[model samples]
Structures are given as C-alpha cells and as structure tokens.
Target: MSSYYGRPVLKEPVWKVPDVPAYLYLGGMAGASSSMALLAGLTGRQRLARTGRLAAAVGATASVGALVHDLGRPMRFLNMLRVVKLTSPLSVGSWILAPFSGLAGAAAASDVTGLLPVPGRAAGVVAGVLAPAMTTYTAVLLADTAVPGWHEAYRELPFVFAGSAVASAGAVGMVSAPAESAPARRMAVSGSVLELAASRRMEGRLGLAAEAYRTGRAGMVLRAARAATAVGAGLALLAGRSRAAGIAAGACLTLGSIATRYGVFEAGRETARDPRYVVDPQRERLRERESAGRGEVH
Candidate 1:
C-alpha cells in the first residue's frame, strides 16, 4: 500500500493506556514485599511479616491479571502451561511465575491468620528464595520480546528492574510496617546498594547492548535511572532506621524505576520501528558478504 511517509508511523502500545498501566505497581509491590517477607522471617515480626507476604501475593496475582488483560487474547494466556519450552523465555517465565505465584500466595495466606504451622514457614522460605526472580523476570519478559530498546538493554534492564523492585519493597516497609522496622530499613539499604552497583555495571559492562543507555529517548531514560537509583540507594542507606527517610528513599526508587521502565518501553518501540535497527545491521551483513565473495574469487 502507498503511504505518505512510505513507512509505518510510530505508535503507542496497542492496549489502552488506562486499561493496562505498566507493570510498575505490581513489580514494585512484589519486589518490596519479598524483602518484607524476608524481614518477617528473619526478625520474627508476625503481623508485618504476614502483611508483606500478603502484599507480594496480591501484587503477583494482580500483575498476572494485568499481563493477561493486556494480551490480544487474555484467555489464551493459559495455553502457555500446556507444554514446556526452554528456547522460549516466555515459556520459561510462565513456568517460573506459576510456582512463584503459588508460593507467594501460600506464604501470604499462611501469614494472614497464622495457620500454617510447619508448612507456612516452609512456604515463606520458598517465597523468600524466589523473590529476587519474582522482581527480575519482568526485565527478562521485556527483553525476550522483539522490542529493540528492551532487547538491547537486556543486561542492564535486569539490574534496573531489580533496583526498582528493591526500592519499591522498601517503600512498602516504610508505609505499612512500623517505625521500629530496623530490618526494613536495612533491606531497603541492601536493595539500593545492589541496584546502584548493577546499574553502574550496566553502563560500562555491555558492548553494543549498552547503546540503549547512550542515545535518544533511551539516553534520557538511562540518565534518569542513574540519578534515581543512585540517590534513592544512597539515601536509603543513610535513612537507616528512620521510617520517614526509608519511605522517601523507597518513593524515590519507585519514581526512578517507573520512569526507567516507561523510558525503556518507549525506547524499545523507537528502536524497533527505526530503519537503523533493522537496516544498518543488515547493511553491515551485506558488506561482509560482498567482502567474503571477493575474497573467495581472489
């Protein structure tokens, strides 16, 4: 078909902006709640522990809902369970998420009324272990897509998502738990440190994959990500034992992480549609082919 631009115009996601807001809410909740669950298990705070566990369960449950709701056919989401495929990240993720959700729910449910006896503690342990991936998988989910910026930022994206998750969890601690949440502050601090370290590594570590951090909308997003992750992480540590400071740090991380995710999504779409992503790479391939042809003839 003929076109004014001779190509597809850039567009936003197919889903309604309102119908499916980004996974920010759920991702953050899951990340933050895990830390709380850990704190509960470690510190022996029954009520907050239960609360965190419940939060994680609720967040994971809702996130899955959002993901399916946003799909072209929400009912078809279950089709992923029929078979296992290692080659497909989505398949792997579906499997990973399945048990994680169950464990998180079990832990949360167990915590609610304190009825698990031995099984509840075991469930909490399981949830705590998987918490990291629960937060990090969203990055993998995005990277697995054909989306350019997301795939490009694969290495760093995980770290970015991780940082955001940690920060978010800290926020939950600050808000729902208690002023005496010493461990909550510590978890927030730990999360901040990990996020900062990972993000810094992201910028210098990956090669061409790192380009997502350097140009256009991606650049702006990465810059903001660095600032937020840095400040939030730094401040969270400094905020040690202060619920207010901890919460603020959590909020900072939350905002920064959200911006980072949105920016990433936007950048991915930008990269996908732009000819450079497809054309330039192929141009290099063609040149290499021509050079090889001449070499064979000579």
Candidate 2:
C-alpha cells in the first residue's frame, strides 16, 4: 500500500471536536476538584471545601454525559461494561469515572445537606486517591493510541495533563470560593508553569514530529492557549491584592485549559493525516534493526 503525505493510513478519530476535548477538560477538572475538596475539608476550610465538592460532582457527572453523547448511543456506552479489556484506556477510564461520580456526588450531597459527615469524609478520601489517576489516565489513553502526536509525545502528556487539571480546579475555586483561597491561587500559578514548561519541552523533543504543535490550526490554538496560561498565571500571582484580578485570572485559566485540550485534539488529527510522521519513524527503526543484524553477522 502506498502511503501519501496527504492521505491517512490510519482511521481518523471518530470523535468530533469540542465534544471529546470537552470531555477531557471536564474530567480533569472533576478529578482536580475532588483533590481540592479533600484538602480543603481536611484543613477545615468549609467554604472552599463546599465549592470544591460541588465542582467535583457537577464536573464528573457532566463529563459522563458528554462522553455518552460522543458515543452517540447510551446503549453503546453500557456495552463497554460487558467485559474488561485491561489494555483499553477507555474501559479503565469508564470504571474509574463511574465510581468517582458516585463518590463525589455523595460527598457533595452530604456537604450540602449537612448530614453523613463520616461517610462523606471517607468518600472524599477515596475520591482524592482516585483523583490524580483520573486526571492523568486520559494522557495515557491518548498516548497508547496510534496517533503520532499523542504516542510520540507520551513522555510529557501525563505531566501536562496533570498540570492542566490542577490549573482547571484552582481556577474554578478561585472564581467561586472566597478570597481566602490561597491554595487555589498558588495552584493556578504553579500548575500553569508546569503545563507550559512540559508542553514546550515535548515540542522541542519531537523533532519533525513536532510539526503537529508548530504549524497549522493546532499551532494557532496552542499559541493562544500559551498566552492565556501565562497571563493567567501572572494575574493569579497578583490576585492576592485584588478581587477583580482574581476573577480575571480564573477566567483566563479556564479558557487556557479548554484551549489546551482542543489544541491537543487538533494536533493528533493533524499528525494522523500526515504520512511522513508515521513512515519516517518506522524507517529509522528498520535501519537500526538492519544495522544490528549486520553487526551480529560480523
């Protein structure tokens, strides 16, 4: 089979834009929020804890809805549970998300209703343990795929996603919780720094494969996202003094997080459409194998 630069050798992702990325964004937000909730609750910051719990519950539930909508059939989503596929990230994610939604929801309800404190705390602990995994599993999911952009960039995807998740959760808390949320502000700044640095390093390492991040539609979106992240982090640093600044920081961080997801999704699509990305890597591996064989013979 002849592979052309413009033609796709692999099946293009069936996932539509905004939807799949939105699912990723929401899931990260949910997971991070759950973590924030646990920390706040343990620290006795009642208001911040309440906000985090609500965000966790709402984000997780809504993300499930988005995933189901993307699947196009609720029954199809159900069918996924007929058996366990250890190698399938989607399957693993489904199991994680299902229990997480319940735990987060129950915790949120307990907080809202002023009842079941013990169970709520227990659930929050469990959810917190699962939160980082939930935030990061999607990165592994994308990297395990055949898409050159995702697979080749595996080294950085988890950290990038985790940072994005932290920023997203912090942004939500900064906007909704009281001005005393120092942890939220710090999280926004720190996570943005981590995300931007990791992404830049990933692109630097990609060589020609980095084309997915540097040119075309994905590049444009990522550029905007990078700007938003930097500006947001700056605003978050200044947020200690000004309420308005905090709001602006929160808004920018949220936008940056969403843009990051969309940019990543577009980059994967671009990578899949380019034949050179797939071919060159395989060719190099083949050359290495040939060299090894000759060395063995000698």
In terms of TM-score, which candidate is strongest?
A: 2
- Per-model tally of clashing residue pairs: 2, 0
lDDT digits (tens) for residues 103-167 of candidate 2: 99999998888799889878878988899988988888899999999999899999999999899
Estimate, for each residue in 75-133, the C-alpha lDDT of model 1 and write its tens digit.
67788888999898778777767777788887777766678657877877887787777
- Model 2 superposed RMSD (Cα): 1.9
* Model 1: ten consecutive residues of lowest lDDT: 12-21
RMSD of each: 4.0, 1.9
Give residue 41's lDDT in candidate 1 (0 to 100): 67
| Candidate 2 error regions (>4 Å) | 1-6, 295-298
| lDDT top scorer | 2
Alpha carbon RMSD to native, model 1 = 4.0
